[model samples]
Target: MARTKVALVGIGKIALDQHVPAIAASPDWELAATVSRKGTVAGVSAYTDFASFLAERPDVPVVSLCLPPVPRFDYAEAALKAGRHAMLEKPPGATLAEVHTLQALARDRGLTLYATWHSRMAHAVAPAKAWLADRAIRKVHITWREDVRKWHPGQDWVFEPGGMGVFDPGINALSILTEILPDPVHLTRARLEFPANRQTPIAAQLTFSGNVTADFDWRQEGPQTWDIDVDTDAGRLALRMGGNVLEIDGQPMAGENTIMGEYPALYARMAQLVRAGESEVDLSPMVHVADALTLGERVTTVAFDF
Candidate 1:
């Protein structure tokens, strides 16, 4: 079978670590080209400028954007405008308004626009949702803590405006929460702790409708944590290791213990969407982050430096 050609934009850490491997292993996609200032995949065509890539690579019908949230809209806009199916990484865009604009443009142009949530594709996430769908959700508590230094290292863009700080990882938990719950939830109260030197918060505490709450922090020194525990009328459910591990009522269930499968699943879904001529833009998780930013109380924390 001939695979569809895809141009991977923003060949940074994530592109190298996840996207490239996923594309390499997939039967449906070929990494035809890449657009990045300083990164490239060996043996693949590379261009530093997006406009040149778009103009030269007319045969590539799909463009997957792994760029950071701030500059992502322009690339996605250009891709859709150039008659390419667009796929976005998590959070999709820095603002909800820009993503909505992209959606409209894609619809008008009859192109596929996928605002992907990789965490929702975690191996256990679907099973968790299935288990919860028939049960009654009493409460949900999400604790997403990680050492930014380990994950992001020297990436200062994470502390800049639109970087989303702790919410960057926190939104993953929200994505899974929004996916698994039987009913929708909205943020009610939030407390955000901002570093004295940063434009985004370093930690956040969020309370939502329907007894859902979250605590997100980026200052852990040792083993990182990404776990969500839910209390239901039937039993207790837990998803640890960023939704890769599942447990029910203190008994561990069967699932993958790593997040290695998420991007592959995402790419597969994107292929299906392209084939079906459909767009999947679920902004529920991003909406929760926006609400936390708007309604959250601000607190200044000690200055942090990498």
Candidate 2:
């Protein structure tokens, strides 16, 4: 089988930390080129602009946009219009509307477009999802708190308008929840805490349909925590380590307890979809964020320093 040439755009931390390694390790895909203004990966073709990248890799069939959501839509659209399969990072686009637009373009061109949630590909997620697929659920709770300074460092775009602030990490939780839950969730009420000096929220308390609730904060100072719990008729299901560990009824369930393969799994799935000429366009996760931002009440909070 010929390796699918994948052009990675936006050579940011994530593209270097996760996507580049994943692409290099995958046998079904190869790094054909990269798009970034001021960064480059050794042994990979680097283009300072998207135009040059596209021009050089005219035969490359896949382009992964690992950029921020604010500017992702344009790159993804450009790739789709160029008749290339477009792979989007989590939180698909700046708005829910943009994802739909890219999907339509991909459909019209008979190309595959993947909106991947790296968290959903965590090892424990699929098993937990399968376990809850037939069970009756009572309620769901999520507690995702982390120190943004440690995770994001001096990334100021996180606090800018449309940058998604805490929801950037919070959306990973939403993606895992949406993928595991059997029922649909809708935002009923929310309280977003915004820094006085920033345009985006720093914390959020969201209430969703069917008693689904979440508490997201970017102020934790200790060990970062990512956990979700489900009260079901059969037993209790708890996912810790951001869906990398599972416990049932207060007992640790035995299974693969690793999340390092998330990006690798995402790339493999995207390759499969592209080969099949299908699309993996999931919008339910992003919808929750958009809904919360659109309908939630706002509260001012202290300014955070990185």
lDDT of each: 0.95, 0.91
Q: Give the TM-score of candidate 2.
A: 0.97
Best by TM-score: 1
Off by over 4 Å in 1: none
Worst 10 residues of 2 by lDDT: 251-260
TM-score of each: 0.99, 0.97
Q: What is candidate 1's lDDT per residue for 1-306, written digit by digit as tens? A: 999999999999999999999999999999999999999999999999999999998999999999999999999999999999999999899999999999999999999999999999998998899999999889999999999999898999999999999999999999999999989989999999999999999999999999988999999989889999999999999998899989999788957889999999999999999999999999999999999999999999999999
Residue 35's lDDT in candidate 1: 96
Error of 1 at 90 (Å): 0.9
The weakest ten consecutive residues by lDDT in model 1 span 249-258
